[model samples]
Target chain A: MKRILIGALFALPALTAMAGDFTASLSIAPEWRTDNRDSAYFVAPPVVPVQHRSARQDLGLRFRDGGFNAQGTLRVLAREGQTPEQHGIVNQFYYDGDLGNGSGYTFGRKVISWGVGFGFRPLDVIQREDRRSLNPPPLTGVPLAAWEHFSADKAFTLVWTHPGHRHEATDFRDQSLAARYYRLVDGNDIHAVARLSGRHALEAGAGITHTSGEEWAFHAAALYQQRYSKTFNTLAESGGGILAAANPMQEVMRRNGLKAVLGSQWTGTSGFGVLVEAWYDAEGYSRNEWRRLDALTARQRSLNGMAPASAINGNVAWSSRAFERPNLLRENLLLRLSHDDERWKPALELLVTPRDGGRVITTRLEYQSDRQRVSFGLRFLGGAADSAYAQAPIKRMAYFEWRLALL
Target chain B: MFKNALALFASLLATLIALPALAADDIAALLKRADGYRLLEESVRIETLVESYRGDTLDKERRYTVYIKPGRRSLVLMKSPAEAGQKVLMLGDQFWLLMPDTQRPLRITATQKLLGDASTGDIANMTWSDDYDGKVVDEVDIKGRRCLHLDLSAARPGVTYARIGLYLDKASKLPIKADLYVHSGKRAKEAWYEAKTVDGQLRVMSMTLLDDIQAGRRTVVRYQSIVALAAPDEFFNPAALVRNTLAGW
Candidate 1:
């Protein structure tokens, strides 16, 4: 028995030697906020004077080696609000392994494919807001306490690549494939995606996204990208969205349809370039359906008894880095201009109704220092819109915003 | 005549013994010569193609007219997407960014590390000159290519990685591979360089980084082109880091 105990002790060193590399860091940020508006629900409510503060702490740990890697992160937010104190925790874990040759396996709570154009949204968290019927509540305080809940959305992504391999020689040869599967904890939703792409000087690929749940949807897109010159290139994509589930709202409004987008960017010069995007939504009534649903479901209605029933919006922006400095720092100054339009039909029991259309100009300056970044910007809103709770119409407002990182 | 012959044989034997030592010393000198260009000033144009595991690929290509003056300063200026100008400047130990729209420069922390090849080493830290004193350990062949092996140890605390083993190409006298160990006695991370000659100079055209512990995941950085740069002294000034022209770069 003593000899056996000695043998077990000897194995401990071998086990410890196999333990690989690890790194970890912790960050805490506490913020103080003063807002003129009481809450997100109050549209132009008399600017209230209020002070609030919150702190968020984040921790990340990583362990990696030749065969596998494991990473985890935890984030906690604690807030002192006017209504009640609130705190929340979020955790994520990821594990991946090499299948050999240019393929790999990954399991985690990660971003999955299920969108059109540049607007692909990941499935992770869902937020719901509470509303009242009558004069809208002030824009301050916690919006919805009961609606906050954690959802388990886990996914697996299988990735393979030939031309995109890290080695330059391997990238010169083409062969790659990627597949993804995702499901929500409630078993209410499932998403599947598959993509096969490569570079043979001229690159082209196609993908399909299928989603089924309480609300079923399907999306298919094809992309073509080509490098024309040393400084010039182009990419084009086309896709369609379909609702497969039957809904009384969809039948009443004929709202199920397709959305498409086309965009391009050019980088021929030293400090100046342009990106232009154009989009079209074929189902016009979809906007009206959403607005009507929002109005009907609002827990609290504004005093003026106005509720928006339908709206449509379009916008454009331009950015440039004409002024720049050379050093370890990379900075760019950008200016943007945009315009939007919306039409609101009041709920049946309301008094005033009007179509709101307006133009907005936003200018922002951003600076990035290594991993740290900061941005400050000003926005001017000019438009005519209907008010939900107030008898008076909403007017234009302007404000400046700033964001910073502590570490 | 017998005594004379004995002395001659002894001299020949000594010469034979010293030949290997002389070759080893020559190789070490060659490696030192290769490490001589401590500072490099250049501009880079990069095109990135990101392929997602889900089979989707994104092409984000950018051009930067940059100035990298070793240990002292680095600057980057962007020239496309014409709405705002952005610049980043690093002077000495302090870093700053300038925004054209707001015209403000913000300070940055040194602990912030970018997720790229440059982040793996204190290549930008002048203190690296004192971090690890390097010595030629031995001569070995890597993948059939003869190389001079160098072992480096930390001379001070906070030197990023703890130990580094470099395998330098004997023919070109340039570093071909590096095994970097971090966190004071942990395992190492390996990086391999594929070099090409451009404009009469040997430069790392492409590099591959592999986690020594993790099997299949690696990152590759390819240098599309590099141009020699002549930068103004003010470019490295910390005060200029936040200027609209400097920040927007």
Candidate 2:
């Protein structure tokens, strides 16, 4: 940690030429929802569930000079019936300096993307993501040290990352490392990457992308992970006599797993883009397994008053590592269509878990007004009552966000 | 006399049809020369003002500063209007767009539209000799200005357009007009280039792009204060894209 801290101090130059270029932005969004998931757990069920509302505020600042740049964000969150919480996050703090001879390194917290897929990148094995918002933020970055060297036709990269706030590393020798090699072949960008991390897990992936003609853009990526989790189920504390004793989060087994993504984008002269992606996650549950989760959720909902007495009933709520969780199914498909222009953008996104028939639809409209942006969006989730998305407490919601960038 | 006159007419017709085939050797050279006149220097800085209009209404007006190393790299920084802090960086074939508030630059496709009528390809690429093969097809006069009509095709994949039709000034060999087409030969857009003498060298002053798919929609970009200045590679990097002081407006 001290070495990384010293590295940051080295990025600041004598004159600080870019200090005057600093800029700041503020965003305020108030949300209203029809089905409030918070009420399903935090509040007691009665004649009427409280209307769910929240006010979210965010502030951002950035500064860059020469090869040094720093950026951070602050969030002020308040629920309708809860006290406000303030959190600070650093998005990127790094220096991109050349080390002579075509080799360079970016040492700090930065997002290093590897895969070619749009919505779901199988090779984007970054360890963190925030699923709390309507549109879950992109992956959270890690403290990293990277070395890269490349020429016109070929390149190589190595990255080392620290867990930061994560304490799961079993030993002091827990160092995460990844390496990638990329080459341009017949107008196609092809790359392969391998990663070594905690718990003796090994991961490798490869991807290809091309946009030869203006008509369409094509990409495909496949990743394989060793010792992957098959399920997050385990035994639980006993509460419902002798019938409901096993209800806890436990790894059933570990084995090799594969994930693949295939996608394409169609570009039109009218400035409209249609993107389609098909994703497969072998670590996810099958249709039959989703049925079990659905049954459990239904059982929990039925036992509303008696839920506290039965640990099995409580298992349904304890499953999610975080809220607004991703669809847990074997296969999924995504279709998105949007207009690309300067000021106003309108878009529609549809995601489907084909094997379980679960679906999510989102419609959004955004307006950019010099230094400020405002957006309104609505989301709907549906499927068989027992499916993943349908079993979730929330069914429909709408949100708006307004932002101003003051430089 | 009639037979002799018939032979002359036949010879002229043959030359008209055979001109493009005979000029193949000069095609590559002419394309390279045209590119050189625009690229002028290995590294350059250009200030641009873009105005877009749809039908009878002005849709948008924006300004930007572009730092370019010809075919190697380019950094486009938004200067005025609502998106002042936005920036775009292009290196080799990779493209990244950085918004003022976004965590990092997100990868973008070259075919995506940049403004009203300019695509990412049009902004990312400043040279054509490396990506296109040109062949002079016909010599004609457009409103008293002698022009050479050239047919250009993509020499490699990943290019923004598969085919282009260019009209160059016969006297200076500078580009006057161009039409881009898709793989199936469908016209996508038309451009008119304007050039003027800057620092004793002919340089493109402004470009007007007209949408072929949508009638009555066009964008005009005028270049200002173009200078030959060397910018470090870090100036064109992804991190530098967010540097608000790159050009200092």
Tell me, by lDDT, which candidate is best.
2
**Model 2, range B183-240, lDDT digits (tens) per residue?**
6689988988888887888888888888887799888888777778777655554433
Candidate 1, B155-188: lDDT as tens digits = 6443446687877776666677878786436654
Candidate topping TM-score? 2
Candidate models: Cα lDDT each: 0.35, 0.67
lDDT of 2 at B32: 71
Question: What DockQ does each candidate score versus the true complex, computed on alpha carbons?
Answer: 0.02, 0.25
Residue A272 in model 2: shift from native, Å?
3.1
Measured with DockQ on alpha carbons, how good is candidate 1? 0.02
lDDT tens per residue, model 1, A1-407: 33433443354345335655444334444544333232213232122213245554444343445433344434455555444332222222334343433233444322122333222121101110111111211111111111011112333444443323434222223343544444332222244444443331332333333223211223333323332111000010011111112112211111222233333322111112232333333222222332332342232233223423111000000000100101001111112222111011111111111222222333434443323333333333233332221111212222222222211
Q: Candidate 1's error at A227, in angstroms?
A: 61
